[model samples]
Target chain A: MQRLDPLYPTCPIRNVIDRMSDKWSLLILSTLNQNGIMRYKELNSAIPDISQKMLSSTLKRLEADKLINRKMYPEIPPRVEYSLTNTGQKLMPAVGMMVDWALEYFDEITK
Target chain B: MQRLDPLYPTCPIRNVIDRMSDKWSLLILSTLNQNGIMRYKELNSAIPDISQKMLSSTLKRLEADKLINRKMYPEIPPRVEYSLTNTGQKLMPAVGMMVDWALEYFDEITK
Candidate 1:
């Protein structure tokens, strides 16, 4: 059996939280949740000000995490669409909780 | 008034979430919550496997954020105790929600 680290002690779960809570990751998930599946260009347009490199890297990371699905089409410009996997959908409630918390406490923190 | 970026667009909030969700930050917050206030050495001992450098850096960052209050008493030996500020206490509910979500969905994600 694997030894589980104590909650307050060092553990791998910390890394997981860090990855999931990344600015790009949360925003990407939020966009996908709202818009269903979207093409790469469309996604880029949807999230203004994100550099092309950062957006691509963020998408790649999410896909590697199995949270999002990337479908590619053999078209002239190589059409691609990104959507949430079952695991990604499962994360909705958790992300929603964060967003709600943020909205509720934004004033307190920002002040 | 400053121009607020769209939620879906790139914004500074992402950076904030990233910092708060860092493994060390969460675990430190959890420890502080359970222990009320703790000296630096006590905190280090409480969290096993955390390197001295990482622990020190994490504490500094939290203090800079105004989330954790660091009190240094004037004595023969330097003694410092860390506690939560009102802002930090307010963050409890948000952090709790994340922990609850992790616990509830751990099986699903890990499986």
Candidate 2:
């Protein structure tokens, strides 16, 4: 028997869902999964609809959650890149399933 | 390679995230997963904080997404029950993983 207590906001499942189930986060994950490491500009272009503000905020949240690794290269221009951590990679399978589920039921849901 | 185009608003992945990533849907899924079959009142009690309106709306959305099945018994008092469908059941593994991931990083995220 699993201890499912998502009734509380502090529940682990609730926390994960609150962070991972967003459109931008999923999109960001997909983008990172496909492109390997990406800079802010790369992520911005890859996800066309997200605003700069949204991207920065989401990236900060994802990093804070330890889902992604943000590396800052302090060069002349200070290049920064983002990629999924082991934990984030583990999350991809679930995301894949959700995408598959969505695709399978797209017609039914849309109609 | 995996057709990861969650960029569009109408995209299936986008649709799924928008619908399923909310706190209520996750709670509803957790409740249904544990209880197997539940009535509206059962779901309400299981998730203490959700408003009646939120529960009703989320249930309707989940059914529309073909994730859960809603069966209404038109008896003396008219009972209604909800449970995950095949698709919904398929989603549980991913949800389980998310919960596991969250628990692993709870301290880091909370602090």
Q: Could you tell me the TM-score of candidate 1?
A: 0.72
Candidate 1 lDDT tens digits, B8-92: 3233355356556555787898789879999998999988768999999999888766778999999979899999978788677
- In model 2, pairs of residues that clash are none
**For the second chain of model 2, what is the TM-score against the true structure's chain B?**
0.88
Candidate 1 lDDT over A23-56, as tens digits, reads: 5787898889989999999999987778899999
Residues A43-95, candidate 2: write the lDDT tens digits: 98887789899999999988877779999999989999999988788778777
Q: What is the lDDT of candidate 2?
A: 0.79
Candidate 1 at A52: error in angstroms? 2.8
**In model 1, what lDDT does residue B79 have?**
91
Q: What are the runs in model 2 whose C-alpha is more than 4 Å off?
A: A1-10, B1-10
Query: In terms of TM-score, how similar is model 2 to the real structure?
Result: 0.85
**Each model's TM-score?**
0.72, 0.85
